[model samples]
Target: MLDLQWFFLLLVHQLIQFSSFSMGMRYLRRRTKILLMGRFLYLFLLVIMMSFSTSGQSKSAIANFQKAKEAFKQNDTDKGWVHLEKAIKKGGNTYYQPLIFAGDRRFKEGDILQAIEYYDRALQIQELSSIHLKKSIVYKYAGEFDLAIDSYQLYMKNARMSKERFRASELALENLKFTKRKYEEYMALGAPLEVVKLVFSDEKMEYFPSPTGDDRKLLFTARMVQDGAPTDENLFVAERSGAGWESRSKPVLGRVNTRLNEGASSISADGEYMVFTACNRPDGVGSCDLYYSYFDPVKGWGFPELLPGNINTKRWESQPTLGPDGTTLYFVRGSHSQADDLDIMVAYKDDEGIWSRVEKLPSEVNSSGRERSPFIHFDGTTLYFVSERSPSIGGSDFFMARRLSDSTWSEPENLGFPLNSFGDEFSLVVNAAGTHGYLSSNRGKDIVPEQDAMAEMDLYEFALPEKMKPEQRLFKDFVVVHSATRIPLGLANVKLKGLDEKEVYTGTSSKNTGLVRAMHDGSTALRVSAYKKGYLPYSAIVSKVELADNSTLYELPLTPLKSADSFVLRNLLFDTDKSELLAASEQELRLLKKLLLDNPSLNATIIGHTDNQGGRSYNQKLSEDRATAVLQWLIDSGIESGRLKAQGEGMDKPVATNDTEEGRALNRRTEVRLR
Candidate 1:
């Protein structure tokens, strides 16, 4: 009866919007944007307890709805949402205003049952297909998974929205069904994982846990806040499994933690570099940006520095996870709006140790819904992250994907129940050994319905299921050092080529420790190499047979180039017993060319040798032709012919015995002799 036409217009104006990500009470995620862990959740819980959210019909109903309009006008969504729920209860639903507003407000506020009821009430008034989409989400939250699946299917079938309009939600529905099937398939094998919550001896709120590659330290966000005080978030480190760990006394990260919030960090393999997210700082480029720090034995972590300008933009960027090599970064960037807008991005460190431009991951991995919390395992292939693109399980469920040999990703496998149940689950990290995993959970709230939401979150550890273990493989520690002095060559380049002779990994030795750790499937043939300027490069072959018993520590010696020195070019590849080179040899060939070009006065010989697999005369002619090809290449590249010569030793001078493929691989060689 009262003029309520304005309210209907307001409702019609907002037909499409939703959110994702389980709210994490821990630091960096605590107050992050819509796609990340929820900081608003802490405030939302308090509001839910204090506000009116039941249905009723009173004379003050009209006045209550008016207050909601004013709150929305002020852009105070949380305030407006609280008042709107009250307005709905006070007979405001009879006024022809969209009741879907109250449903979404309750859903995001973690009130699952009431949200469903609100949606049911909305459907009673008008049957919009979009209302089914909203019901599916609330049903999933309430663990009415069958109902959720049905609602999603109905919305997709009944909604008359055009293909251009319905494409996102349509694709999301497909992925949801597929991923949920995979989750169920894995869970059918009987529950093998036992998630054990760790009661921190210090007992502050600790989450975003990442253990060092050596398992010596645990890095996470830790905070302590009283009921009525301002919240402060800081990074904390706890010594693991020793006096520092047993005492359970955690220390604030010196120099790295500031008065403002800092959390969501990733540490390099050698513990020398840490990249994290910081927001609203004086020097920030956006509302939030990625920052980094270097760890020095004498100084702890250095004061944080802004990453490359291009990596941080005017939009939200956070949750950086460093790959095992520490050169590739998998992180998230998004607007502070819908979960559908959040996307995972990546960047690689170049030969000069600079981060290249950021690129979003392909659509095969990311969905229109929120994607965050990326964790790349030590194997360099298995990637774990959180996504709500599939709402069949938890709205934001943890998933594992593999980086294929082609550099694209395999379909995501939802880490099954026990790991991903109802409600919000995120921040799951596996140990370097792939034997165990760790995550954060509020146990009191999980087991007891009335448990206080203010309770600090505790970390949990579980034995990883065998099926969920990272690829069974081996890791090799490569220490790059000078041949003449044995001094560590920090920041040297390291590379590994697969059996197909394509590069499997290209990264640097640690900037401080000069250590480059590599991992691979035990069966693959590989070429290992390391390079530094002012030195002869190091290269070797790890045949599949040799790889079976490969040693853990490979001390690669980088010989300083000088007069009358001969070094085998072990990285060069040839087609079987043929003489012509394979494309795989280009990397070493380019390095050789660069070295010769750098030293104009140094004359060099292109020497070639072959294994004893062919006739002596035939081998001799083949070697000569191969060496001549290299010499011609050098001359054509503007090198002085007078400074170079080609020669053939054939099988006369072999580096190793000419038996077995491993020895034969070593016997066939190209060498550079400084004459």
Candidate 2:
């Protein structure tokens, strides 16, 4: 119809020019000819003014329209739509191109009815074959289902005579069909489709979500371009408000973000201290070390310091997760022994904020396969972790274990089906309420089809099964340490003995510190042994009497034997001044039996000494005979002969004045050692 209008307007232009020429010749009177010619000129000027006025509006609208397009490209969609609206109001239809784009932007932004009004305005001025197809899109998105079908039918009718037109119309019809299907899907879901706005997005990398107790402050990881070059991922934070997250998503700079990668941060429940992982730092012992930044009320995050040698060794230690109570710390460390992957380990903090010895999680929780990202719930007994070792559908899956009434951990249960898939899930944290949790995954359940592969992770909330939500025992301190060093020990031999030193529950500390956690709600007596090279074994009887809510810090000390420490030989007997083996020394050899049994590592040379009163040669032979007699006694007592060396330091070596009987007694002696 608009084409017919343009054709008629062209004919009117020719008539106007012809009429002016005819009128000018016929009129002889100058005033009359001038008046007739003036009327034709007036008409022509009016037409030119209309044409130029339309073109001016076209230029203005096109300029604003271009700005709107630029705004959309900048991801400022809201501002883009505002400018596009202004372009339409300024009569962009004065130029056909502005009219088409204005309608397109409006339709794509989901303003279907507004788009149809603009498209209708365009069609009224020009009947380009393209306008009919846009009409179909407007009707489809506007939920005018029957109108959409009718518009598409008309498009088919118009296209039947032209193959090119038919193909274009068919494509539009197919798009309308897909839109109708999506519209049904959008309506069927009972809840309103809340738009998942990209609060923070980058083409680089992102992970870790450490939110405070109030959920107002969120700390996460983001890898963004720095200094015109791609850089390692670092911690970035944003705050939440009623209007949604604030912009820029600034990095947590200075100490926390170094030249190396740093992430997996955990804030204390009180929000006072934050522990995170910084790999390959200058002071690190291995590939990664757990460093802590204290949150002072006056100053913010302080300088990060590497944890002490008791925990971090020449091995990788990372993923430090502080329990909500802020005392029990959980982390993952690669196995030092022959193991395939890393395991979850834990450490305990003291009143002075010093960490306990690091120990691995129990075998029930940590298997031979890789287990990482351990998060203890607010309840403390419920430990949630990501594991690829378990029978997951694929990759890694979230599994949880509940504490039992007997204090043992219940068999782990997989968080099944829809919550987990064949992709990797990590950085899991359950809320203080224990009902909701968050994790990161690449699965796209809500994204558009074309961008599904690029779908980024967002926070998800899930419920705990009622059976898995048991009350947990609060741990004030599980202080297990070495007896000698007065230090918290790792990998010590701990057994629950039945009042009589019988073995019961036994395991080593986790990798975080030497403090291994086991359910002790019902145990009677705890027997612990701290073992190390060159130290006497020490055992303690921790009476589980008058049990209190908070446990006490028990320390054990071990004593070691030196080479000068001597033993008595009761079985060695001889005639006056004679050196020979006698049955009497057998009783004294039993004492050596006890020492060997107590200290399995003790190997020594049994040397016999003599007083200065005897001749040197005779004393040497007599001393040798005495040493041989004692060695034979030790052998008879079942001591390994290979462990005993016999040597006589005759009259040459005397300890005291030797003039006194007590000094001579001391001078004639035997010694043993850890050889």
Candidate 3:
């Protein structure tokens, strides 16, 4: 059988060489018949030889082969390989099936060298082109670029390869060469920044580090491996202390974590909401689907629910990342059966909180090659992701795109060498400040001796170079709560209108924590408003001088609506000492009208007050006129006259002492008393 295999290989090689030469038609025809006859005779003898050799082989070798198959089926990978090795030693080398199976198992187990050895032995017995391709892929991942290129070239040279296969091999070879050049360039530049390994990392695979906007808490995925095989992947959370992360981690979202695999999570800016990937669930629409859960202060994590059908299809979907505003979700969607092609897609939540249909990013962001691990910054305009598109350093490199005003994305820019190396770099998350960044990488220098070095995927934090950093903007991260009770006011609408009177941004407070985060372009002259159904509307002008901190925490207080509750209307403005209302006060007036329309039974009195500068009788008439003017405007705008009243207090009821200009400015105000 061994001789027959060798003879067949030699005959095919000679035929390939013969076909390469120019010959007459008559000579070609005669040679083709002779080759066909030779092939037929070879197969006839090969089958007879195999039939006879089955009985001649020792019983122990066959038993070992059978045991190897059973061990592999029973999930005993190490024991299976041991038995296969013994079987190969006992005259099993004549059979290529066992050798190929062992090689495939070793490759999947991260034993690249052992897998290559087995593949080489199988190649000696038969000319299998796929084995060469598999060896090339393993070599490429192992950082053996030169050997990988050589093997790929060998695969391309085989006569039996299809044109499509040849083209793929050529492209892979070109990418490998490009990667080699990038690696050399990186070495020349030296290390760009310091990368600190977190203390939570262990011998098991730990990756996908997602830190809260403040960088005080971290969430990562860890594979639970037993006997050198992964049982499931689950999420672990750790807190930061001083400059170092806590050494220990605990499982979070216990209700969400089932026996099925769950990993690749992205937490909201306030750490209240999470969207992650879960696979093999009985209710999943695909092989993997995205799920969401919210953190409750009392009940802990709420039950996880699969995302809507618009975002998840029969095709695989995973790696969800929520945008800074908490309404946009960026995730990966691809066909699991075709593992090589993935695209970055985004879905946005409408005002009613229903997620829009998923849309794939343009070719500028998602190329024909794979693109994954999208990380939209808290700034909302800058996006960081991984892509294998052209101009990449290697396999999958980090790239970034900025959102333009027209809602289209800018051309992606490759985050240059060192930060993006020959191996895949993904799961990137940047802090709100944009000074530091975290990502998962298996660079050559990051190998730990105690772990399976070939499969070492570790979390790393590095100081972001200025060129690679996202645009730094001030993010007002605040929680809205009731002023009297201090209870969180969830689902409050937050809006930021710029000086141009354009509604620049709008978002809602988180349901779990009442947290609302908005990114500004450092233009502080804007109005920020928070409103909910049952609470009084709140609005404040953020002056230019107030945008200082990278992350400013503000406690937005909203007073609950009740009978006889009165407060100053901060936004309503009138001309100095006149009854005419300013145009800037239009927004506040409309909101008050809406409040009245929303609650038909509610009634309010519009009261006007003044400082002590004016004469008592004149001030009384002026305040009365102003109060009547406001009441008439509301009546003209369709509020029922029976539900409104107008009154004035001329320097009689001053909330602030009229001792100075600031005090006097506060005293000249409009107040609303609900009844």
Candidate 4:
């Protein structure tokens, strides 16, 4: 006999050759023979058609798989899925490669069922370590802890080549056992899985909606590590609405997001400015430096400038809190003299409008131990911060302190209870409403999947007990600043006035931003006047603030007061006998006319005053006429009547003593108040 293999091949070749020959012979005959041959030829053609069609379908299926791979690699996940579906429909058995890649892309993008479907297809083809790992991650995200653990174990069995991979496998194994135990305990404690979401995921560590108390904006820090390589931590902000946070979380770009690490940002109440820390740079005072920037509603962020030398030094200055008033800056200062210890420092603006050198907060607030993350409440009286120095249930507990009557700080009080655990808590912010806020912690249950053995930091919002509502109150910020010199001014009295010019509140600037934010309740447009001994008082009005107001920055550009200037009283009290002044008084109102003409949009009210000598009714009438005379002069001087108002106080209201003649002369005056 011929060799067995050669004999089998020879048989296959003879079958095909005979089939072809018989097909040719059938086509050649005529009449009955031709008809039979035509039938045979038709059968032969049918076989070829079937074979070619099957081969074309297989090729198309393979092409689709290749296309899916290309699409996935290019990060076009949606298109990749479409191509993958096409490949699956072609009824071919060679689509495992593309399916596996698609599964990975979907898993990374947070898609679960679709990823499992593709992963299942890949497993059907062959057992792959990478595919098992992918399945494990999906299982974790799906909350199937047990299955995810098994998948991870299987992956480890085959992928023990690299030390890093081995370490990762071991860690996963340990975490799986730990998680199983914790799950049992949680169930035993009557806790639900939904509540467990308060924990963080190891894969994504940054917690949003920072505890900063302002709901209009959210501040958070995210470490931008790529492929396990160190990258600068970045600070990001998101605008919050009742509808929820908007898309495109805005990054505090530019100097705030420097090549060096810059994160842990806090925005003042009005959201006009922010301060954050940057570290490991040549410009840094110690290992880190605190820098600040202001946000203009119109022009955007001013360049990041270093804090005054008084606040920054050879020591590390970081974790800055731009107080609600923008006047006081509270921060953690790590002293070079103390080496590793950190103390909280407070700085304020002095009377000359300069920041005082950093002064250590009273011992009640700082200690030899580290105290950081000082958040001044919007009310401008309460301060919340993290301190390891205080007694606590954890490594670091949050504390609150009240600004005492004498301007010293109260003894710090721990925030207490379920809000504190054996784990450390950091990064807290509360909204003006006070019922809700956020804090970062790792003390809760593990959130990482069995496949991820890494520890995670979680963000949680806990409500204070009902009886503690008063203690849980929150504050907002209100900053008053100069239109020029972004620096904050000290000792500048900021008087917050209501629409009626009644004093509502008062405050002074802090060291960080030349601003003073005060506290008030109710709805009213506010007029803020910043006054110095000699400099012209700066006045501005803030109107139409929605409810739950905080730091509202009102910038004032002051004009200096002078001695030589004398203002004319066009609409003075009436002539010698009459209580009314005549229209001819317009001549004396020339200066007033020019002033109103120069500022067409300017609005002012002319108040007429008279000496105490005339009859009460007659003086009232005379003062009224004098005021009307000024108003008429303004209208004639091209000032819009809509922009002018005349009011007569008569002799009833006198600025100086009305008894003495000199005092009477001063009392008989006309004054203009601009709105």
TM-score of each: 0.67, 0.40, 0.67, 0.47
lDDT tens readout by residue for model 1, 435-483 = 8888765432432211233253667778888768997656666789888
User: Would you list the C-alpha lDDT of every candidate in the order shown?
Assistant: 0.72, 0.61, 0.76, 0.61
Output the better candidate (3/4) by lDDT: 3
lDDT of 4 by residue, 1-675 (tens): 225434544555555555556565445543446455555655665555445545767677778878877987787878887887787667355446667766776666667888888898888877788888888767865667788889888888877468886875686666555445444544564533221223222333444334334466677766544785445677776665564555445565444676677776666554555777777777677677777776644556567777664777777777777655445777887765424787778887553335675678888888656887777655556777878763444467777888784358888877654455445666565565555556666554532222221134545555543322323332324444443554445445555545553334444444445554344444566555555433444444465463145444445443443433323242233567564444433223543554455455557787878889968988888777777777886787678889889888889988789879979877877777664
Question: Model 4 residue 584 lDDT?
Answer: 38
lDDT of 3 at 369: 83
**Structural RMSD, model 3:** 7.8
Q: Residue 352 of model 3: what lDDT?
A: 48
Per-residue alpha-carbon lDDT of candidate 3 for residues 625-670, written as tens digits (9 for 90 to 100)? 8888889889999999999999999788887889999789788877
Record all residue pairs in model 1 with backbone atoms less than 3 Å apart, i.e. clashing. 30-39
Q: How much is 519 displaced in model 2, in angstroms?
A: 20
Tell me the spans in candidate 2 whose CA falls farther than 4 Å from its real position: 1-198, 201-204, 225-230, 243-248, 296-299, 335-340, 350-352, 405-407, 444-675
lDDT of 4 at 616: 92
Minimum summed lDDT over a 10-residue window in model 2 is located at 446-455
Clashes of each: 1, 20, 0, 22
Worst 10 residues of 1 by lDDT: 12-21
In model 1, state the lDDT of residue 550: 40
Candidate 1 vs 4: which has more TM-score: 1
